[model samples]
Each structure stands twice: as C-alpha cells, then as structure tokens.
Target: MGETSKRKRKRNVSLTPEDITKVFEKSMERASADIAKLIEAITGGDAMTRLGVELEGMGLDRMQVIRVAKYFGNKPNQLHIHIWNGLNDSYKPDFVKAILEE
Candidate 1:
C-alpha cells in the first residue's frame, strides 16, 4: 500500500479596507433614510436564515453571525480580523445581505 496525504486548504483572499467598505455599503443598500430602521434592519432580521445551508457550511455560530452584522452596521471603519479571517469572499456578502434584506 502506498502512503497518501491530503492537503489543508487555506483561503488567501486578502481584502483591503476599501473592499470591506464596498461590501458593507452593498449590504446596507436597502437602508432608507431612517437611522433607527437602518440599524434595526441591518443588525437583526430574517436575513441570517437566508443563508440556510451556507451557515452550516461556514461553521459560523449564531452570535458570530450577529457580530458580523453589528460589525458591519456600526463599525465599518475598523478592521474586523476575526470575521475576515474566518470567512472567505463567498460567505460574506450573502451573509450580510441576508440580514440587510427587507
């Protein structure tokens, strides 16, 4: 028998601050003029469940997902290394848009 080994996959997708900002803006596109509604809409909503299967695939717990939302909603200026390192590009916009949706 021959010995074989599987390689570990690494996501090397590095997002610049601008890229993060772009994604954030896209997620909040549905926000209207009302600040309260905008915050409510973005931070907590049915959007999280929108990613159904993708949630399990990404291994993101509920709080982490909420944190992602809050991070985008409130602190778009900061570099959120945790979510950035944990999720790749694919799991990003979809997750954010899920909550951002009306």
Candidate 2:
C-alpha cells in the first residue's frame, strides 16, 4: 500500500480590535471617496431636475423621484452603471434602464 502524506492546514491570522477598526475606517474612506466621485460627476447644472422629470415620467412618485435625483443626477458618468447595478432589483428606474441599454 502506498503511504498517504498528510497536508498541514494554515491557520487564519486573527485581527486585533484596533486592526479591525483601522481596516473598517480605511474601507469607509474608500467608499466615501467613490461616492464623492460619483456625486461630483453627476451633479451640476439642471441634471438633478432632469433626472427628477425623467423619473416622474417613468411613474415614480414625486418623493421617489426626488430621492432618486438626490442620489443620481442626469449628468452621464461611467459610474452610473455601477449605481444602477447596485439598486434593488425591484427599484431599477426606466431612466437608468435606457442609459444602460444604450
């Protein structure tokens, strides 16, 4: 019979509380920067208003339109697709859908 060799498993390195906190903070900073870039790219001019109008036309209520506008204005950007993909399946807006289709 051939002898089977035992493989040693590597132990996972445990992170300290401070290390975890630092990691969390860095992650949050990166997320904030990403969101800031998206906002900067989408904001300015009457983009928000245009987004509101489009959303309203798509059957979203005024409040829903406002929330969507505040989150993602009409100024086209590379990140818009990411935002659209991140939306809840049931909440995808027609305006974004058209943009994505194009």
Please estimate how well model 1 matches the true structure, expressed as its whole-model Cα lDDT. Answer: 0.55
For model 1, residues 1-91, the per-residue Cα lDDT tens digits are: 2333222234457899999999888767645436667654554433334434444456777876666556544554333333543677677
lDDT of 2 by residue, 1-102 (tens): 333332223345789999999999999999999988877565543445554565767786676665566555443563654555456746756555554445
Q: What are the Cα lDDT values of the candidates?
A: 0.55, 0.61
**TM match of model 1 to true structure:** 0.23
Candidate 1, residue 11: how far the Cα is off, in Å? 69
Relative to the true structure, candidate 2 reaches a TM of: 0.35
List the candidates' TM-scores in order: 0.23, 0.35
Q: By lDDT, who's the top model here?
A: 2
The CA root-mean-square deviation of candidate 2, after full C-alpha superposition on the true structure, stands at: 13.6
Off by over 4 Å in 2: 1-8, 45-102
